[model samples]
Target: MALPVASPVVIRFGRLGDTVLLAPLLRKLHQRYGTPCRLVSLGECARTLYQGSADVAQVHWFASQHGWLWTNPRRLAVALALRSMREAPFYICEPDVRTRTKVRPMLALAGIAAEHCVFIEDIPLGEGEHWADWLLRFADLTPAAFAATPALDASRQLRAPSIRATPDELAEARAWLAAQGVDAAQPLVLLQPANKRTMRWNGVRAADDDDKSWPVSRWAKLASAILQWQPDAHVLLCGCAAEAGYLASIRAEAGLPRLLAPTGGLPLGLLRGLMELAHSMVSVDTGPAHLAAATGCPLVVLFGHRWPSMWVPRSASGSAVTVLGGLPHTPRVDQIGVEEVAQAWWRLPPRPVDIVPAAMGERRARVA
Candidate 1:
């Protein structure tokens, strides 16, 4: 019997950050077809991309066994399951050169014929094109929907475990602060000091010594300066628990107010809420920077290899500025000096006392 035709779309990237980066384009696909799209994903990123969107109706995991029939039972099981379910014309979207080679054979073994497969290689590299925009060129869709600002829809909203901090979670965060003898009344400034591998490849490369983050001594200096400018302002160091030592180093150097690593670990929703609550955020070109943009927080981002015009935050209500170095390859940490970062922060428009405050306060109240 012939199976029902499914709107076939496969994004083969394995990183959560990349999946989030591609979300706008995915939303565009949903808008254009008004059909639920299927996702073929692997690893932790499955959680990030499949946020229960009406558009993303189903998700299939990539099977690992390809060389031998019975070598890996799990891989075979996944493949057989997908085959028995249905077969449809499949499109493979590869935005990165590295992923293209890795994902080709995997798709082929899953009963996706070569003729039905579409490889993306035509997207041009330019000064002002976002990574999202560059990826969207692969799909048979218009750029208008891709360029359209994303609204806070059901899919985009952070689910309970990811970003939405529960009442218990919020109480825990406050309790932790109190235990440390730190005050929570003061507005929080979030500092995300690490950069992921792709971001490093395109922009800031990792430091050779101990695989530590880009020398955020400059960021520490700037944090101190912000506090000097506003003594009551408190800074919160945020990242995975694995980043706790790095946070400790920054805290020692900068004398930052409270260093809070999510004890239960940061789910995407809580991280978004943290960004939304922050008065501002200073980060390297990383996933947190992208997540921060979704919160409409005032952001000053430092761009190294990537162009600011293409990837800078795109919120209508908030202010954001990106400082870019004029280098084609990843910009060295030293190239982006503290003065440049401070200058960008200085340029942020002052938050309006009445209207803006009311809107933000309302959002906080709702979250509370």
Candidate 2:
């Protein structure tokens, strides 16, 4: 008889972009162990990410206040929220030191046995190791395992993150795009101009960190150039609701009045479906860029704050080009120029003929 399968719990509490980076790790787990494991996360995007995901058994949302885990009610709340996973083995994937401190106490409170959990802190990531590699190592898996995992050999995993969208969601995206005057004939270029992590209020950023958002001025210039290069291209802005203000600023700054801004809000699933329809996406270092990569949409990503070695967006095969910050540790978006991004877009394999809207008839028929 086969031994009982272990039902592991995965813990990752990073926001949108971090969650996108986590995709490959989850895929490998699903390949190794066929069942979906429980995932614990704090990101709103996590729910949508794993909704139909074969890798996720269920998602537990844990809300913790800004104060330390040692505090009263906040600690108790976290403990209660995670009480369900007390009996299962946990794969703790959060890397930040502060998160590590909080996770241990929560596990103890939730009645989880100490031996049943594996923390990233147990075997800290080595110097220069990619985050995904760090995760595979955390699982005590061999390097050969990583090599054997399809789309993970070498750096192929970078382009291999995957997400599934429902038929209803695809219909909604197409309907919404049709309403917005986006047609199948022209190339749809998604321009994600907003980076919420770095935006400031009263000149104070939420965290004094840099996630590398390309400046709006440069984005406008790039938008103008894309239009010049691909005359039939339609530039559509995309981001979470929080980044609306910043997106509007880019729109005004770019002076492209014809840019399509879909009416009302677009949910994560709808946005993902739209990504599949897009010809190419040009994004600053952000979450939507990752979603685009999962759809295998041709992408050009601009990286400034984080090193590409640490957080470059991955896509299957050669679907993405990462432009890193030229300056040392504190590089600004200006470090990358519009010409370089346009050049990267130029290099993408001419959009495959079968993926074109005209050839998308079969998919559309299925949805119909």
Candidate 3:
């Protein structure tokens, strides 16, 4: 069945990983509906993450969800813009009850009928299905608010989520790495030692905060281990400029020349670009760790009690990914040891020959 000529709209407030996961549904919808989607996303990265992709028609982004319904002018403006496209079918991916409450009135204010919207909370997910798969399946679910919803795109099955980085973006990444004196001839190993909360607090610990971080000292130790086995390996400490001092301190703690921290953090596009060529990445569970998985970079990711499988970003590209934590026994990522992480990295399967550059090969390459 074909959709109406109206462009589809999707609502998801997501980070790099979420956006990466969102790609498949967008791809399916774009193919089925024959139009790109208008995305209502949150924060700086969601907008940045989809810059190179054709699936997103326009990105309506705001700083944060704080006071979004009343005080956020950007949110208000987006509602007004959607008012003009009132006929377009809107898919609400957010499952939070409070969020739905805020969204309902805003859409009503824009003169959108309840029948025109689809919400994911309408039903329970099938057993052992990935959230991305659940999202793909939920689009076809007709909301009780609407009579018979148009059968959404389900013909095209996305094996895994994939984000496309532009060729120009790849070139820029190479230039940036080369400028950083990153010798592309040798293996480029990335250590994404910081997650959003870790960087947000500048690695600080506070009461009532959820944490999924490996110790910086462990990160420092991991860097040394990489150089110990693979002397020529360039271990890039990944973080934003705000986390520069923190990453630098890790580099200093490691006390090794191979470990280098970029003065600037790896931006979303550049990070994707580099991941395509990177030998591997090791990190605590975070959005970029998901991004690495999507890009097909071999990964060793630490985890916590949260997101046993639902939030786990399995490699869409079928890249090797090693997970090291979960519920019952391993409550926090910090409980995972440095030696285990190092051994996991050692155990990661080699990058498939097709994705490898001419100069890129085995991880055991050593400097003379």
The numbered model that scores best in TM-score is: 3
Q: Find the number of clashing residue pairs for candidate 3.
A: 0
**CA-lDDT, candidates in order:** 0.55, 0.66, 0.75
- How high is each candidate's TM-score? 0.71, 0.82, 0.89
Q: List the residue pairs that clash in candidate 2.
A: 158-314, 158-315, 159-314, 159-315, 159-316
Question: Pick by lDDT: which candidate is best?
Answer: 3
**TM-score of structure candidate 1:** 0.71
Worst 10 residues of 1 by lDDT: 157-166
lDDT, candidate 2, equals 0.66
Measured over all alpha carbons after superposition, the RMSD of each candidate to the real structure, in angstroms, is 7.4, 5.6, 3.5
Residue-level lDDT of model 1, residues 48-119, one tens digit each, is 435555556676665442355346565455555555433444545665676666555455456665555555
Which wins on lDDT, candidate 2 or candidate 3?
3
lDDT of 3 by residue, 1-368 (tens): 23343667888876767777887778766765667877887777767667766777778777667685668788788778778767777888887888777677678778987777888888667766678888887656544554443565444567476664667777887888788787777788899977777755445544135557677789999999988888877888887777787788888898888788877777777888888778899987788888888777888988886655776767766778888887657878888888999999988987655655445554434331
Instruction: Between candidates 1 and 3, name the one with more favorable lDDT.
Output: 3
Off by over 4 Å in 3: 1-5, 68-70, 125-128, 143-155, 200-203, 206-210, 357-368
Model 2 C-alpha lDDT per residue in residues 109-155, reported as the tens digit of each score: 78777666666776776766666667765654422212332332443
